[model samples]
Target chain A: MENPYLPYPVRIDEIITETEDKNLKTYKLVFLNTDDEEKFIFQAGQFAELSIAGQGEIPIGIASSPSEKGFLKFTVNKVGRVTTHLHNMTVGDIMGVRGPLGNYYPWDRMEGKNVVIIGGGFAFTTLRSSIIYMLHPKNRSRFKDIHVIYGARTPGMLLYRDELTEWEKRDDIYMHITVDATDDPDWKYHIGFVPTITDQKAPEGNADTYAIVCGPPIMIKFTQPVLDKLKYSHENIIMSLEMRMKCGIGICGRCNIGTEYVCKDGPVFTLDQLNRMPKEY
Target chain B: MNVIKIDKKTWTEGIGRLQGFYRLIGPVKDGDFYQFKALEKGESPDFSMLNTRLSPKSIIYPQSEVMFEYSLDETRDDCHVIKEIQVEYSPQVVFGIRPCDAKAFLLVQRNFETPEYKDPYWIRLYETTALIGLACNTPCSTCFCVDAGSGPFNDAGLDILLIDAGEYYYARVNTAKGEKILKDSGWSEETETKDAELAIENLKQAAENRITARISTDRLKEKGVPDLFNAPFWEDVAFACINCGTCTYVCPTCWCFDIQDEVRGTDGVRMRNWDSCMYPLFTLHGSGHNPRDAKTKRLRQRFMHKLKYYVDKYNDGIQCVGCGRCINLCPVNIDIRKICEAMNGFEPEQKSI
Candidate 1:
């Protein structure tokens, strides 16, 4: 019986300020022990509890793909006390990461299908993980096609700028990056909300296609209809939910939408699954 | 399945003997009501009360438990590293517990000891303790254990069931743990199996007959969740609730918690405290978005979770064991039985032109 509450120690390797407001930062962490890294097996769309010594723990999506070896990445928003402490900490500072918690994207069902990623603003962390995962050379051949419709309030608020730029030049994956109302003259991408771009650029739904959507509730709420209008069935739309979580193993009991504990049974659910549950979330 | 007859004169001696081998906890009169507390040396568990005010769940999952301790001094060897603290899992006995309260542990154990993950703190304490239940000879006004998959003499959760026989007690050993306790306490007065069974059955029937409250759960499993969630009666149910959180605190099946860090200079301990859904902060997100923002939503969540969600998830009857602690302790007189009836009988309103 292993202790699920115990967190593995990691040291902050690098921190990158993501947005213009300085509210979001991507922290690259390396495990203090090689054994800990070997034990931390995770997939895209899963999350972890980032623990601070005297401040509390917060559940954040794991932004790094497992294909990228050596370190784990978490793009944390400076909204609460623990995250604010993490934002103020310097490199080489030690912290705790306690997961690989929650379910991940349906890669088993998603094999040999087109993946359309719809994301907006700060909710793009795990989407970034999924994109990087699908783009890896060894993994690219397993999927048919990849299309991304991502947006932010402005060009300055978009995350993973360097990766998005490099992805734009790739012929293998179709990338349609957009900003709500950007005035930057150098911006060559689309100019609209995610739902609008998704409507215009997303592939027509078929049995061979699946869409993974993660974003603000407003973005998800609006993107759902566009995907539906494109003839995507309820089972093909995958979503990640947000809830205030304590013990990521589901014992804490606060993150339930219905009988399902989002920390254990989900964070990832198909629209078909969510339809059967209460709309409280 | 062993029955031993113990005289009332030797009950205190047996308790004192058991105390030497294990930590003893049971209901004792505190101020105006009874509560479960650890018995000190030479102290015996008082067994005359109908029920305790607070549940004995705190014995397994303490209200506030420290999980880890750390030092922020940077000069210390374990600086900045949150290390799991050493916890004691000593053998214990909960003597004279109600059958309903003991049954709550079984319902709550499903959450902590799931197939995927197990809570070491809760599991360890629960496994090491022996539950000695005192069968209800007189049912309380608020008690409705029969409808909740439990009864006055329910042995589902207890290791041993003790039947009060006026001048003596019939200790019906239900598990290996119960037998061990009897052996350790040196109580070897054996009773006829058929005779003890007949006597216990008669007592159980009379006590159950005294319960008049009925909770209908037949339609709870079949009701549309969205219709129940959006029911108009929720407003009436939540109208008087002050969100004081007394209902959750006194509930044995409510297991939600909040983790925090308390600091004393350079030393700190990370602990988890009991949290309530009745509070606005329970479901509030870090991004200033709260799904359960209003008290109506929170109140709905509490009932839906206990009566509907738990029923659907485990296909067990309900998360509650019908202990009636919440009914007795709630300041606003909110009753779960009434809410359960509304949900079980709810039908969506029809739209008209």
Candidate 2:
């Protein structure tokens, strides 16, 4: 039996700093072994544990679409010991990754439905993956209209600016970008918090609409009510959770809200499911 | 279906004979309390005690176990490659373990050997060991095993069940492993009549009758999750808790663990250590957010996971084996029996918010 805890080595091929503070960087990793690449298939909302061996390991959501093959991408924030070590690495440095763990977003459930994605800060990684997946030419016709509401604390903190710019130019989807308050003359997007912009810009919810929200806990706490006021039922609103995880597998008991292990049962759950779980998370 | 009798006078001889075939482990006096340890050349188990301070789980699932080892020597051809450390699985017998402790292994096995994933380290050790349970002829004041799906003489998870019958030990061999141990020990004496079986049954009944404590778990499943999470009694129950990990460390069925990597010079080993939910760090996120940071929430998580979550998830009884180690060892004397009864009997009030 293969050890689930063993991490496969991968080399960083490219690194892009997404924030002005240089705290968040997107790394494109190519597995050292081709067999590992063939075995690592994951959906948008799933996460992987990135490690620096002697330092430690931390769970980071996959930031690139699975439809784009050959390499994996992770957007990391330099917050703790592991992340600080990860952010200091260059293009050729090798790191460890163990994953494709946890359940993904309910893409099949949202097929042919009008989709709305709401994101804030660095929490936009998985939501970005989902949006890119849905907009891919091969899968484009499967869904109806798509809308995105993303924000950060300031213009300097906004991630994937180039991609957001490209997305804004496209006629296929509606993209609403914002910041809490910004003085940048080049800032051409809306200016407000995520919840306020979500209420003002997001399409009114209906039975055919599926809204997926991902952000800080405070953003999620405030966004749920806006969606509810927009007449979104518990079943139609989806969100991805963030929890401290060790083993991406279900064995480590830290990520459980009730009986459910977030690493296994979800990083993604419907608002209806969240309503049934304890408020600990 | 084999029955053997070993006289008290020749018990050492029986142990000596078994030592030739397998490594022996049993409860022995450790300082002021008793703990399960590997028996040495002349050590014998003290069966006079009701239960050991800690369960015999470490014999199979050790508190800190190494899973993989790697070297970072630059000149070596296979340097930096993580290789599994080969563990030798030798046949061993855990002798004189209480019936409740033996039964706890079966409950823990459900988590370690699940359908989707099998923990190789835990499974390998578990498969190579044989459990020889000693029937509890004298129940402790805190024992409630009878109300928790295991009685004083429960044979659900034991390979062999031994009852002290005054002059000799009356052993009921339940598995092929148990039969082999008896056959190889050279301590067998056929039962001449049904007298031994009748005496064992009467002793089991008497032992169970001494247990006056009971906990109601039937209503736990019927209660709503939100109601249980927002119960008013949590603050009162958790008031005295000092956040010490004694309960989880001494628990028979608490299986939570944390993985860590240790490096020394050029060599490194990845290991897992027993972690408790009572610690605030257990659920602390990397971004400085802790969901169960409060003492009341941590206390609720411990009991809720044991009494409510495990019951709902496995569709079985509570995760506790009712060995009462936590009750006996808690510095603050936070009794699980009282807390369980409070949870089981709670009637939720509608949230005004």
Candidate 3:
């Protein structure tokens, strides 16, 4: 229910660089206004627009969990003009961050349900929010089962390497990762695209099960069919969307398909809501 | 029933008196067409005329406007908010608006000042703008305002109504704001009958004769099932459409808008600009999926919305002023009236008047 249009100035205390994938990275930032932290918290599955003076702006997901308040973290990819400069930044660089914008996975509705997490390539940035929220100790019993099927192109391209290892150590969550082709001799998770792994896993799906997936457009297209075979109803399957978002709010027409505004009605939606949307996305 | 008449010479004085109290505005003859221009010391808007090239909504909701400016300081976290103070709007009088445009302007109020989504920019402009609906002395062939529930002398969405009878004119106050302006303008008095009726009847016949085309919409609700969504009858109507958004742009009630946020350094202002559904890019997703991709499907969406969908939702027909701007502006001459006629083709002989 937060206003997508209002953006508070968040100070970037520092920026962290993760992954040598050349196209993507993550930044850990701390809000300068301590008071705003209490009021300015954002949910996982929500995103913020990061901007630099004269350099341009881009949408980056809050890779850091909402529960971890004071500091803000963004897992971003250097796709276009703004993102390219974003990757070249130092720790003290000032950038504008607006939002916890768009709808997040409603955990209240998602509780007591089998939760499936799907991530592909840099699109995994959006899922990092949900992944952390599910892994949080306080919210563990709300979900029946937590499963993550994440994939990337190669070893160096994989994001959140340290966190991925730590999360995998926990017995409560199931983490399965795959890569298109891995050169690392030590690597032994899986060796195919995400969609292939999804098809092979064929997780059980019922009315109570929820599937959340994000990644490259191709991965999303392929994985949808796999989830369908699992008996996951469209209403129970959730996904995040990406577009060339300018105003991280619904006011900008660029991120809309018909009456649906990606920044307002959702960046996260059940497949049921997605069905009502014009097939443009 | 007061019948007061004045010469065309007194028109300038009347308008000048309006200029003394308000930011007086009305339609002025812009070559062959008319446009809403501010009334200076002595400017009486032409009453008997064609519609304006641009809508009066431009006055409130401009084509493009800078919302606010932002400045980024590399050292600071909070953005430097550059407050934009627009020029003060004088209490204004919008004179000589056609009945169709009046209705269109009235419809715009919801998007601007609705309880849930009140736009301060649109509201500020609307607060100072007053409308004076002018009767079309020689109504155009394409005018179906009456069918749309507004007409040559329609006063549904006006603060004041004016009807032209040859050399002189008749005026009726519709709102308290309009009544106040009338007192300030020192108009003789509003008449009870005859002059307004004579002008209305003359224009009505002129409107009907010019609009030789007809379509039955009462059958639309009965037959516009999902199966009829892609009927073959669509091709004939869509064949002439250019997809330039002229229909939507000139339309009095089309209210789709696009939001834009521009951040230069650390500072930025978000803006909401007008948008149309006709554009293919509007519905295309980042995943490269498009539902209403087909031109035929989009074309159907446009007419169906006018005749069926919006009606179902609002309990009112999607507003079309029937000003015929869509007809005249369409590149291939894809007339809306023609489309309605084609819709009737879905189940022709069965419907009766």
Candidate 4:
């Protein structure tokens, strides 16, 4: 029997360097063995523990949708040791990845609902996976007016800037971008925090919408009141959570917020679910 | 080497057969407390009361355990730390381990003995220990192991189960190791009669009905959140909670832990320590934020996890033995019964295939 504990050695076919930020990069990956490709499966918003050669595993969300089956993808920020090693890898480098574990975004319920996506900083990576899955060719029409509000600290830190620009142009998406400080004139947009822009630019409280918020703790705290003022219910406000996870499983006993394992029970939860957990980070 | 019965008139011969074990642990009286203790003198263990002071979680998943040892045996130039583990111990016999606590060992053994994160320290203790499961003659208010599929005389993980049949114990050998011990002891068998069956039933009824409190977890399992999330009821139950985690520590099945490195000068050992979700730091990271900070939030977490999350994910509740040690030892008297009763309203939708 194959050990669930042992990670399958995977070959990194391609790497997509998005933005000039020293931290973030997106890798386009496929199984080395063709048979494994057909057998492989993962849900949007689920994560895998990826291992670089000579470095151990680090949990990163499945950045590409299950709909994009030809290749597996992950958008990682080189904040720690393993990621730093991953950032130095070339096309043919071999690494290890061990799951498609954790829950998925409620796409079945999310369909036809006016979705408002609020994101700030590198935390937007998991949200980006949800957006990609929702906008696929077969599923795009099922969703109502989609609004994506994204922000970063500075022009130097803004991830997916070109993609954000194209998204802003598309008639389908009601997209908005904000930066904490603008360094140059090339960027023509709001010059303020994401919460500030969110309170001002969003198409107000009239429609039925599920507000998907992801960002730094400071941004999440500030944005909660803006959403409350806009009359979004706690159940309707879904947010992504980040914790110091080691096993990325419920067994490690590390990610217990109250009793919920953030790695298994969440990484994505409703504000109502967050209300029940311990305040510890 | 078949089934054997020691005469109830002379139970000492049977106990004498277990004389060679380095440690003979049995339920003994300490003031008013009846707990698991080392039995240097051969005496019949006390089982007329409730469970022990601890749930036997420490024997396998110890509260404080050394993962490995680092040693330096040379002077000056040759003084470099060599990792070593003291993985040997004299075989021990534990007396009167409840069915719930015994079954909990099944869940705990998998993690420590597995290929991933092979904790040799814990595995050593497990290998050397022999369990003598005692039948629960009086189930307390906190027991729900029967709901988790363990009974008063459940022989799931034991080498031997000594069922209390009023006058004397009815011994049942479960594993090869236990059968070997019995075969080595000179004994003869009498056919299991109807009288023994009647005595067993009487013990079961006394254990269940004598305790005035009851919480039907089956109803809680069927009904999920409506009763559980009502903050007012949860607050009432947990109002006196001091967050001491005594209930969790005494709990035979609360297997949560924390890993830390103890550094003394240039040398250090990484150790895994017991932790409870009730604590503020159980979920706290170096970052200045916590999700389960307050008493109400922590209380909600404990109830929801045991009643819903574990069942939803693992297909079986990990809380194997419903040993009431947690309830008995909880300083605040925060009863799990009231909490489970309140949360037995929302039957969560079954997982879609």
Candidate 5:
């Protein structure tokens, strides 16, 4: 059997700082071996374990769409050792990546249905991938109206600013950006928390509508009720959770909440599924 | 199945003959307790003890095992490439093992050898090992293996089961490996006496009957996850736990691990070490959030995973084999039997302040 622990080598082709504090950076990586690239097919909302060989490995959500061929993108926040080491690296520096792990959003099931995406702070990476995938020319006609409600603590903390600007001009999707509170003169978006903005701007929930939400624990805890009040069934409100993981193959045993191994069973779950699991995560 | 008898005087000679063909491992005196270790030449297992302090899981899944080795020397053509270290998988015998400990390996195998992924290191080691279990003639005060899907003479995972018959040993061979070892050892004296088999069965029943302890697992699966998560008794259960990680390390079924890369100048080895859920660092996220940060949460996780979650997931009784190593080794005297009964009997409708 192939060793799941061994990571394939990749090199950074481009790096984009997404936040003012320079805490978050989006790296565009190209696999050193073309065979690895061909084998690493992934869907939106799935994650991969990025490693620095000596430093360690950490799970990061894949931030680019599967439709975008050739390169893979990961938006990493400089929170711990591995990310700090990765942030210090420049283009051409080698790193290791293993996966396309965990279950992804149910995109195939949402075909011809209205899509509602709620994102908060740096947690928007996977949602960004989903948006890009749903908006792609080949996939656009399969989905109906797309509504995006995204927010950050401040205007400067928002990620993918250029893409947000481009998305705001697109006629195919509706985009609403916000900040908790901002005084920047260039700020042209609403100023409030995600749940409040979601309550006011999100489309009325229906049987044909599917909602995907990702954020910090507090944001998710509060957003669930807002989605509930909007009449979204527990089965339709999807969420992506964050947990400390190792092996990403489900053997190390840290990401278990009840009997579910988040690395293998999910980083994504429906509200109905979450209701059945222990609240450890 | 085959039954053979070996006189007490010839047991050492039989072991000596087997050692010539395979490496021998068994329990031996270690300070104040017994431990499973590789037997040197002329050494015999000390079968006087009820059980070993630490489990024999390390034989198959070592506490720290190297998975890959790589060199950083740029001049070498294979530099920076990780090569799997060649491991010796010669046939070996784990003699004088407790039946419960042997059964624990089968439970752990469910995690390591799944259809989607198999741990080559663990699988390879397990495949080459033949377990020779010593039936418990004297049940310990803490032993509850009878309640955990195993018993004094359970032959679920053992290749051979040896019962002490005072003046001699009655060995029951359960597999081809066991028969081969017995035949090679030249101890294959067939016992045609029906009284010997009757005596072994009587002794097994008496030993099992001596174990008066039991834990209720009847209601564990019926309880809701949230009710158990929010149970008010967690603080009481977690109060005495110091998070020493002794229980996990000594457990026969606990299989959590942490992987790290070790570098010594030009060479690097990626290794995995045994990790415990009792530690705060086990679930610490890179983003400064820990889901099981509090001691109560960590303590709750351990029990819930073993008694409730494992039962629900595998539909196999529980993750615990009930060897009672944790009960014996715990500094605070935290008993799993009590916790299991508490969880199994927990009523969500009754609120406790």
Candidate 6:
């Protein structure tokens, strides 16, 4: 039997400071063993425990799409001890990545449906992965129309700026980028909160359209009403929950919401499912 | 099943002979209280005590266990690489364990050995240790095992169930492991199968009838999850909880843990220690958000997990064996029996105009 607590060794290949504040940095890691790399099959919206020796481990979402190969990417915010230690490390530093833990977004249900990706602030990591995954040439035909409404506190705080620009030029997918309030006169994007932009630009929700929302609690709380007003059924709205987790495989028992272990049963649950559970998270 | 009639005089000799084959862990007297500890040379288990202060869960899952060890020194060939620690999973015999504590293992097993993922650490240790249960002829006043899906003489998780009948022990071997241990211990005095079976049944019935305290769990499965979660009686039920985590520590089914890395210079070991839901840090998010922030919320979670959540998830009995260690140890006298009664009888109030 595989030891669920054990982590696979990975060496840091590159590190990119994503936002201007330098709180967020994306690490590109390569598995030390070829066999280990082959074993790590993952999907968008799933997270992994990044193990830093002598420090600890933190659960971070996998920011890289499965279609993108040879390396795994994790966009970490330098908030706690393990992340702080991660920020000070240099390239080629060896650490460990424990999983492709937690369930992914409902891809089986989303297939052949129009996907509306709504994201805000630093939570755009997995959304970026989803956007890249859907835009892949092989996967592009799996879905119909794709719309993305991404927002941030400021223009500098937006993640994957270069990729956003490239995506904006593509006619295959729609990109509506916004900021809370930016004073920069050179900024060309819309100025509004994510919910406002989502209300203005997202496609009319129906049985055929699914909106996957990932953001801070405030953003999610406000955006839900907008999606509901837009005729989105409870089941059509997908969300990813945040919780303090250890043993990402769910045995450690801290990340539970009701009987469901967020690390195993979810991190991704629909609004319909959330309504049945305690509003604890 | 192998039935043996061993005189009380030979019991110590049998245990001593078996100690050479397996590590002996049993309840030993410890200054007005009994504790489960490894038997040193010439030591034997004291069966006079009702039960140990703490559950024998530590024998399978320790209070703190090292998962891996590593070195931070770059001079070494394997610097920064975490390696799995060498754990000695030697065969062990937990002798004289109460039947209620033995049954607690079965409840905890569902969490560790699920269909999708099996916990390697828990499964390995549990598989190696054979439980030798001493049927509780006289249960404690706080014990409510009868209604909590376990009985004083429950043999759900035991390899052997030993019943003291006057001068000899009626050994009921329930598994091959039990028979092997009994045979290897040089205890081969056979008893008539009919006589042994009848005596065990009578002892089991009398012992069960001695338990007067009872808690209702029949209605627990029928209660809705959200209705029970938002019940109004939680305030009174959780009023005296000081969040000391004593209830969770003494609970055999409370298998929650927290993992951390401890460092001494260049050497580091990643270990997991028993964690409780009552602690504020248990659910505090990194971004300064706490879902279960209040004392009432934390207290509610512990009961909800054990009573409502476990019932909803497994559809089995609650995640408890009615060991009553928590009841005996709680400084505030926070009783699970009362909380279970409230939950079992909970009904949402009708809104008035």
Per-residue CA lDDT of candidate 1, range B1-353, in tens? 88899888888888889988999998899998989999998888888899988889999899999988999998876688989888778899999889998899999999889899988888999999999999999989999999998999999889999999899899999999999999888777999989988999999999999999889888899877777887899999999999999999999889989888999999999998999999989989988988899999899999999999888888878888898989988889999999999999998895211
Sorted on TM-score, highest at the top, how do the candidates line up? 6, 1, 2, 5, 3, 4
RMSD of each: 1.6, 1.8, 4.9, 8.2, 2.1, 1.3
CAPRI-style docking class of model 4 based on DockQ: incorrect
Considering chain A alone, report the TM-score of candidate 1 relative to the true chain A.
0.99
For residue B112, model 1's alpha carbon misses the true position, in angstroms, by: 0.7
| Model 2, native contacts kept | 0.53
Candidate 2 residues B1-353, lDDT tens each?
Answer: 55678788888888888888899999998788888989987677789777889889899889999977877676765555566798788999989889889999999998888787778888889989999999999889999998888999888889999899899998988999999888888878888547777778899889989999898888888887778888999999899999998999999898889988899998888888999999999999888899998999999999999989888999889899889999999999999999889889888777522
TM-score of chain B of each: 0.98, 0.97, 0.84, 0.81, 0.97, 0.98
Q: Give Cα distance to truth, residue B63, candidate 2, Å.
A: 1.3
Candidate maximizing TM-score: 6
lDDT of 5 by residue, B88-149 (tens): 78999999899999999999999898888888889999989999999999989888999998
Using lDDT, rank the candidates from best to worst. Answer: 6, 1, 5, 2, 3, 4
lDDT of 3: 0.70
- List the lowest-lDDT window of 10 residues for candidate 6 chain A: A246-255
Off by over 4 Å in 6: B350-353
Residue B196 accuracy (lDDT) in model 5: 69
Model 4: per-residue lDDT, tens digit, B153-252? 6777787887766556677777777766665544446546566556666777766565454556666545434334543566777788888878777776
Candidate 2 chain B: worst-modelled 10 consecutive residues by lDDT: B74-83
Interface RMSD against the true structure, candidate 1 = 2.4
lDDT of 5 by residue, A259-278 (tens): 89999899999989988787
Ranking by DockQ: 6, 1, 2, 5, 3, 4
Candidate 3's displacement at residue A155, Å, is: 2.7
After superposing candidate 3, which stretches have Cα over 4 Å from the reference?
A1-6, A28-42, A48-62, A88-90, A244-259, A276-278, B1-10, B71-87, B112-116, B166-168, B188-245, B256-315, B340-353
DockQ of each: 0.69, 0.58, 0.17, 0.11, 0.55, 0.72
Clashing pairs in 1: none
